[model samples]
Target: MKNHFKIYISFLILFGLTSCSKLLEEVPKSQVNKDQFYQNEAQCIAGLNGCYDNLTDIFTHNLFKINEGSSDLAFWALDDADASFAISPANPGVGDIIWTAAYHGVMVCNATIVGINKSPVAEGRKKSLVAEAVTLRALYYYVLTSMFGDVPFYTKEVANFDDLEEITKLGRMPASDTRNYLIKDLAEYAPALPQIKTSLIVGNRVSASLAYILIAKMAMWEKKYDVALPALQKIMGIYGSLQSYKLVDILFRNKNIEESILEVQFAWSATGIRKTTLVAAITTPPRTANTSIYDGVEILELGDKANPSTSITPSDHLIDIFNKYPNDIREKIVMARDYNDKWFNRPSRDNFEGKPWMGPKFWAIQMDNKLDGNNQKVFRYADALLMAAECYNEIGNEAEALRYINMTKIRANIPILEVYPGKQSFFEELMDERGRELMGEYGRKWDLVRWGIFYDSINNTIATENEKIKANLRPYHEFYPIPDEEVFRSKGVLTNDAYKQ
Candidate 1:
């Protein structure tokens, strides 16, 4: 999609109707008759664009809160009381918002797919558009199944109120079935997507390489190293190298670089509300009182009344890890001691009060702090390399694994490792490296969960924060509870036994 593209009014009108109710709810037959609306290429593309809009909605501050805050790397600063252990179904925190947003995306994709299939658009265009919709649907389901163990699955779009009974009566699909479905969908449709995006007009759209990466990621989550390797290898051949970490301007400022596989596009010029993202406002810290340290440097304005800064500070553990690799440029780029300056070490308790270490990865240079146009990086080449390294290590190819790991390290101007103690040790190093490299980008909680370390890691290292967090670290906490609203809406069909009464 073009950075400056306007969301079509037709799409807004259609999707607006569906968003008001559950994922399975139907629009009035007179309001948006899919048979009448999706007659030509423009309408079908608009329907696809509606599907893309769901992604923008999903990648918001709420998503960041649930994904990262639930992990050990960060915690919700605003609602620490209820948010510390937001894993419970009983406590409807950001997870419910995430659940609703993801399913909404799925619903839109389903509608788009159904509409495109019926449209009289040319066979090639119809197939490609439907493929895109299918891929997007799979992505939403992938996220849903990853977060909420089993989720209500649907392929058909709701056409009328009568369809609600059938849709609502459906139950959650097992996570294994969900993964297999995603793998199959991606594999089938990925080839239809362009291998490389040739222009900025289509830059943020998913590509074949991205689909492969997603496939590999799903396989990795299931510990199917063999299944993930070929896809990762395919990605390596297509996007061969990582963007140099030394080129700070190209690294963060420029969107859709050689390093970027998939990013949520945002531009100040894009039409519609929130054309820009609030990541800058959410991640940036409020300026400290002592501004004399950087005499003339201007601090990026923090929380405005309209869009207040979220004050999401990095954990002290993350700070210490970065300090271990002081020479690494990634450490400098991702976090800071003061505004726009690299954090070398943890400051004394008193010195660290207002100046909590904050992630600068998404902080754009623009002075308008509220409306940031910085594109959020969803997938990057570096993540692919790390994933490939992990796959190789799992399969006992330590040499190949280290080669990929060292390649990433070399780009950061850090020393390459010549040895690893064992596979477990290498995996530990990888976990740390991923935390350092992709800290503010989100994905840590899922990573820890897939690694089967969520409980131990949080209880051992992170639970010291409070008794509430410690008490909430049960086995079932690995999978978030389905939102109570969703269960209530499902009536007897949906259940939330995982949550404590």
Candidate 2:
């Protein structure tokens, strides 16, 4: 009975592997029994922390990165992108991280739920644990549905490794089936969940408000407009206000933002603690020695945390998108110019020094590391308003569409969005607004893909990249190659076209 959190997670992964493989007839080699664990409340909380730690894995980042890379919101590199070693991505459209991360999150959820079900904790605490588990499960399932199209749904504890093998044998579950599972569980648990009272940095378990937002999002994805509207209304009551303009620090902090409906919980409280600063380090200006700036490489005291190899730079298109939207709040979202770049004509001309690109959203880690405090916002109020406007526009309510779109502009103190009397092509304007507002946030890619802008933009990017370098383009490149290991491992059962490595 070591009672260490690390040991708990080790066993958790084993339980998942054994269950997926069907090789464990009894107990998987990877884990200990419930008798050996969950002896007390502290242990249970530690186990929950272990579950939260699962997101720190590479898989999660990969799955989530698709929201940025595959969409028109970002391009691989600019005409002058600094990463000299940027290679053409296989499944150049989607990354391989999703394949592993989604499954990993699902596995963690399975183990945690199993632990909660068997734990001796009070029924009230058990319910809280269940609520957290269900929300997280729904999130991972949401990612899987968005990426792979369909995935199996498992709610019970896989007693051992062998149970894992049994489920992997079944191929993809239909998208409708998986999404419905999310809605069912979220609906049951959300009402009992409380609102997150603290800031974002601390991993607040599933709050009622967060659950409502997530449920609303899932409903919207399924096109259940009536169901979605009510959930959104619930969230509006809790966190409807936009993040204030002055609390720029709020955006940079790891704590709960006034705008954040939900965020993945991550922490780096101990040594070897991993944080989400990969994008920051990659995009920060390369620090030459003796420079005052803490570029990603310079900041990492151990080995340079900067994966200068797979860097994320602001594309020229992204910069142009920002410029097109005059005086929008998104400009404050990411800072690119020297203190001042425009209006170089006045007496204070050239007063502020601007770099080719630098944005606080990506680079804020320079000041503090929890890279922890800064959450990658999964659901924010801005998205809600945008979606409402898009919906209104679709219904030919130009007046109503402008009403929602103007909300964002109003907050930014920019010229309010205008709608023509016979306004058409609202979708086009929505896409345009998303690029400027959500650039580098990782949601743009899906927005572009869903809107059918991927093929044209991807081809344009490939042609542009290949013209300068040398790489063959293929239609299949749109999806990332299924990892050969996953293909071979899942071969006996449940293999499908997406896994055609």
TM-score of each: 0.85, 0.77
* lDDT on C-alpha atoms for all candidate structures: 0.68, 0.54
Instruction: Report the C-alpha lDDT of model 2 over 157-276, residue by residue, as the tens digit.
Output: 555546655755666678778887788789998876775432442555556766776676667667676676667667666655554523253353444565655555443443565465
Model 2: ten consecutive residues of lowest lDDT: 80-89
**TM-score of candidate 1 against the unseen true structure:** 0.85
Local accuracy of candidate 1 as per-residue lDDT tens digits, 367-444: 253677667777777888999888998999989999988887888777777986699988988888888777766578
Query: What would the TM-score be for candidate 2 when compared with the true structure?
Result: 0.77
RMSD of 1: 4.7
